[model samples]
Target chain A: MDKTYPSIEEAIVDVPDGAVIAIPGFFAAGVPRILLQALIKKGVKELTLACGCGPLLGATEELTQLVKNRQLKKVIDSYGLFRSATKGLQDPFEQAVRAGEIELEVYPMGTLAEKYRAAGAGIPAFYTPTGVGSIVEKNTVTNIVENRKPKETKVFDGEKYVLEYALKTDYAFIHAYMGDKEGNLVYRKTSRNFNHVMATAGKITIAEVENLMEPGEIDPDCVHTSGIYVQRVLKVPRIGFAITID
Target chain B: MAKKFEGLPREMIAMRASKEIKDGDYVNLGIGIPTLVSNWIEGKDVILQSEIGMTKTGPLAFNDDIDQDLINASCQPVTELPGIAYFDIFDSFSMIRGGYMDVIIMGALQVNGRGDYAGWANPAARGLDIGNIGGSMDLCAGATKLFLTMTHTAPDGAPKIVNEISFPLTVKGKVNMVFTDLAVIEITSEGPVLKEVYPGLTPEDIQSVTEPKLIIAPDLKEIEL
Candidate 1:
């Protein structure tokens, strides 16, 4: 296990087309931007991407541009459409969704994170009361569950709960504040949003770090994602050092 | 924004909403007027929680003090309090779904007679597309109580306190109280009870815009903001 990779392309070279991926970040913080750029440069098609928010803004143009180029076939996320109410704004992903070019599934903010956590823990499914009487329970698609298992809606002690399946992906691309060659990762502030959960939910978790420390440099209590869960780590260029990608 | 509704100013609405929050309560502040409540409750002992996984988060950060890495659910930079703790999205939401949050102050699009409010999606715009339902559903279901902050009327001059919501409903019958530009209403089993109206507007003016059966308080007076 020395899982460190030389470059973003080498880290993601084996992520074949039609793979499911979980990209961890909320808004502009802690995203695996270089990895996403590598995917864009790789020109892989028919992808299924999972995130806390769908097709993030304020990050890079790579993922949205990929969607614009008709690369993503499906998206699983919590906040899919733009949160604002003002009409006539153009989002290419939303346009693709309306035009039947992309399939979309939305989860409650809590449910989205919990599903991934459950997947990482090897749980099959769990019930939650988040969407009891709303449209989320009424119209939620059940086919996303593994084995195409039919979701069951049951009442527990008078509260309605919907069975949400654990979500696992082929790869998880994450950004961490620091990492060791052995793959232990630490995240900064609120940027730790989904990266910790996503780190465990992917078959192959790849981390892009701002700093790479020695094995004993970081405090034992400060580790966010342990080395046991991460499969690959890429020490990216330090801040302000321009990284050229071919 | 919309001619001020001939009622309380935005600050007064925030002040009134602040009064409803108890000391030592765990609150989730939504965007808009609800965020202003934090500024008014400066010295009061309230623990602010953000769904993006920070508890005991302090006031909004000044531009110079802003860290792009430290942001609230609204994507605005915030400072951490003395006892601030950061967790993953799983533990953060588990706190909400486990009913540890005491109150949630959120903005509203439309609220119906039954106290159900629609805050997330506008059916008129995207027609049931996956618009931002961020933390509304979880907060409504798991929070001990829910408070709403909104203007009395839509920008199109239509009533927002309607008999039924035309937009997609975020949560149903979970709203305990609503603070609006015109009046303060408490949602009871009977319907929305108008407790106080702003000074310039009459019960009739508030009633004209409210489609629900507005039961005026026995001693309705001007809001003391």
Candidate 2:
């Protein structure tokens, strides 16, 4: 726990260009929207973003907007849930691709999250039969499942070879239910995923909390994430506003 | 006897079939034509689910009164019916991953003879990329049954249903039946079993429209006029 950042933008320090980032927002809940805005103001680019679905809240949104505007370079997102009040997901991303402003890699959400978790845990990758024998398996690295005798299928084990990809991140953006002055973070249920593991997988970790409580206020059993991985914190509203209200 | 497509808009076809969806059935609507089914299948029941998260999903917002907080697992803003509840994204995905969904309806870029599907974001098609596999992969893996709704051919007359999928696949051997503009084809181990053809279209006419080999059921019916 090292919560001491006075503002969300302050927590965005140390992020570098071309960093792979993971955030906790599936469709809209638990998205660090305001912090993402601050990160946009912080100006990092060439982002490989992984999340449950689409949209980037902080600097990633800004960078995506910049990419849409031709001021930025590349973005790899598994989902195309980007919404720009000024530009829809299509126009900007397409324009960028046409103008060579960015490259997007659409991935499956569970795979993306699993990859992040694997990378955070320092495992390179694992095999999955999810996309076997289909076009989605094209160009994907193959992993062999080992269960029965390798001679049975003439492969490795009696299992088959499915594709897998590795996920590595430069920074992981997370949302917190509560934070102490020292930066220890607790998560609200369902709104939390990939945030904790993503925090560790990245070179830099940023957290946005709705409330800032004293260090001792968090009950030991209820605390989902310890504060060590969290480098900075910006306290915001209790997911009531300044967040997705739908 | 079932019906075939009747030259209706692709969206209209998907919505019309929503009538077949029963109450308390855990349904998963994939992107594209399936997304519009929500607008048509309204009633006192019929829970709508998007891969993003929300069940009882409503139409996309027309104004700012939209609740951003209320969204499907896909992240699209949606209206909720009474009795809507929230859970962990993983839990919802687990339900899908665990064979709990009763029906899954999604638009497809391509569905091969083996019933493989391609519905991930295709930047090459419409310049739109509003898809992610938050739970559909699991939904496809574990759904009780599946439905597909798309037109018979591409704008260039290329077939979307074929002997083999030419596009990248999202799931292999997962589709049950396909609902296209010209007909409804049920996928069987033997291959595509033609269930019906749209009204006014002959089997010969459909043969000319389709690139893949087709088989007519013993009791093939006409699509609704």
Candidate 3:
């Protein structure tokens, strides 16, 4: 079936309020700018943003507007409080948290990514040694907002590990280098960061591509996130970065 | 004109940190002054790993050379060397936790004599509840060797090398050495020993600022910049 949508607005039209959406981007790279702008225009409220740091300094204006508009109710990320030394201000996400407007659930960067991957792979949970003895393990429950979920800690082979549950979001907003009508995708260089895993972890994965081509256009070997995980696709004009369509 | 070195500039600390990384080492450089280690090290034999999923990262990219899509752990745009590889964050941490990294140089707020460090948060006002630990803990638990790079004292002149840390611990018994603005210290089973000091600074001077007692190394020498 053809997965292409005519406009970014139409692609994101059905995302409802309070949706847990995994936005795939690291700082500014690989952000779905047009789709995020569409969500802004849609005015969806109480969004639970499951992704990396929220709208980091120098992020595209559209993504930054999401936080500026106070649309997100919670953020599950590792670096939500990150303020670039060059940004010269407190992180907006951190400010929102301090103002008691936004809830923050910080994870170690790897655990965050693995939770998404585990969800996509149908794994219930996995244990990691990333935070065995530190405050990360000691303050685990306190860092979460409202004790939304319970984490079980266990020891194996005399080594301690914290159990991180799989994370499945209501939807995923992904940006890619190239995609076909069938929804197969490819991402460029470091831009691929979290998008590939976030796509698979979403209940409904929607992709916005810089270059939308017919089936077989993206070589089979080159596809990063396969079409099976991507349910919707839209093509937006390539902007800013130098991207070559194959 | 001959250059007169008055103090340990950030580049000097980075230069000392760079000496710990041998050629062909798979190293992960943390943010701040530790990131400058790449500038002092020559050639491409050392491969740099970033939490954002890249290996063999080259020097910082500037102006026209900057690719918005290519960035390091600090989110600063960077160029890639030949044979650079990319993976998801999962794979990146696997390499970290799996003991593939030879060295991880990071900035720290405090380091006790036991080689335990606390860098991610200050010990005040529920800081752990909101602190951004990021990958510090993971790198600490994973790296084969951990090096801390920092100034000797806080801006208020408080010593950073202490008998104990007031800040929340990032990892215990991970820091093998500390490359600071004033000295190079190795944390051994017996505790911190002063291995080298900057020019014009005596072992007694370092000891005065240091909260913990420091043992001067038998082979202690002036920092050879």
Candidate 4:
């Protein structure tokens, strides 16, 4: 019943090339940095990455490295570029897309989150009023990636909505503040962003926690992500940002 | 280069927009000038919502309080206020897309006479063939009221308030009001009505930098802080 792994490498050893993987975090906030570094070390190529931010002006070094290494074939994300205020700084991912090195699909943050939520909840598709008259609506025609086919639009009660399909990945990687041997996760503050829903949407969810606890250490009511959704857990030292690990 | 007009400062526009937020209202602030609205509503009853999954967010986190885990939609480290609650992105957007937000202040790249706006992308920006949408569309569609804060014109001095938006639309006909460096305008069925102008600038002066014809409100006066 123990889901704990001895090393980050072993936890993600089965991730194959061309795997559809979801990495949940907003900027540097809740990212599983070490696991991503492991993926970099593992040298997996042609990864189909579904993440919140892409490259993001160096806020995500590991994710950027994956793109810089030419490891990604396609990216599904909400924010594609940092929209930097400063001039002269170039993003490698943007460069890659411009050069036709990779394919990119951008979604409204809500739609992206809901797609994951739908996948985890067993819903095939849902209607939303988010992109009624924008390029987002046009994306249904422009996007050629598989499973990210043309979207369907319908009107209900005189209102227009676009139908978005669920997004399920081969693997989902998440960072947790605390986790138990049973894989129950506890995330902090805003760091909980997409990790909660992504946990259920992945075929195999792997969590890397700053603190590893015993099964009963985390109170039953306090669990953010239930152990049932997680298949592997690795303990990594908390590195970036401020806050005592205690 | 087009002629640039000197108008209100960025903070002044944010202060003017902050007037739209009433006490006890739940507000969501987009990046850029709209993010400055938080500074203006510090002690008010307004609760700031961050799309990255937080409510009742306090000011930017400083030295001791800085926790990478606690951040706003802009990814800046922020402090947690009393009674703060955190949820996942799905529930956060549900609060936004579900019409729970009383007001949302967003930044704009272009806005038309019909109140339709384009914010996420500008075909002009390099490497931005596909721009970031974030939660803007949902906020535009779901919020009870949408206010936009931006410069009166582009940095190159081109009119951003146009007869028709040329850039890609973020959401159509959703903007309720706009606070720019030059004036405060409300989008009405009649057209864009000028409510307030910067001191010493007449409606004509504001119109010079705006593409769409402006309807001057009867009570149009200098912007009062």
Docking class of 1: medium
Backbone clash count for every predicted candidate, in the order shown: 0, 31, 0, 0
Candidate 1 per-residue lDDT over residues B1-225, each given as its tens digit: 344357667777988988988888999888778988888878888899898889988888885788867877777778988999998989989999899998899899899878898887775677444567767788888878899988888887788999978877788889999898889999999888999998889888898888998998898888877
Give each model a TM-score. Answer: 0.93, 0.76, 0.92, 0.95
Candidate achieving the largest TM-score = 4
Candidate 2 chain A TM-score vs. reference chain A: 0.76
Could you tell me which 10 consecutive residues in candidate 4 chain B have the lowest summed lDDT?
A: B122-131
Per-residue CA lDDT of model 4 for A63-125, tens digit only, reads 578887879898888776665623313667666766667777888889989999999999999
DockQ of each: 0.53, 0.27, 0.47, 0.63
lDDT of 3 at B20: 79
lDDT of 4 by residue, B93-172 (tens): 99999999999999999999898999987546654456678788989989799999999898788899998888889998
lDDT of 1 by residue, A89-153 (tens): 46676667666677767778888898899999999799998877677777663223332233468
Tens-digit per-residue lDDT, B1-225, candidate 2: 223234668766786557557888878887667877777766636676554444555666545745645555544555556666554444455566567788888777788767787765454543432334444565676767888889877766777887766555678888988888787888889888777787777787776666667888899997643
Q: Candidate 2: lDDT of A55?
A: 49
Candidate 4 residue spans exceeding 4 A from truth: A54-59, A85-89, A141-149, A241-246
Candidate with best lDDT: 4
Each predicted model: what fraction of the native A–B Cα contacts (within 8 Å) does it retain?
0.62, 0.34, 0.59, 0.79
Best DockQ among the predictions, by candidate number? 4
Clashing pairs in 1: none
- How far off is each candidate at the interface, as Cα RMSD in Å? 5.2, 5.5, 5.1, 4.1
Which order, best to worst by lDDT?
A: 4, 1, 3, 2
**In terms of TM-score, which candidate is stronger, 1 or 2?**
1
lDDT (CA) per prediction:
0.81, 0.62, 0.80, 0.84
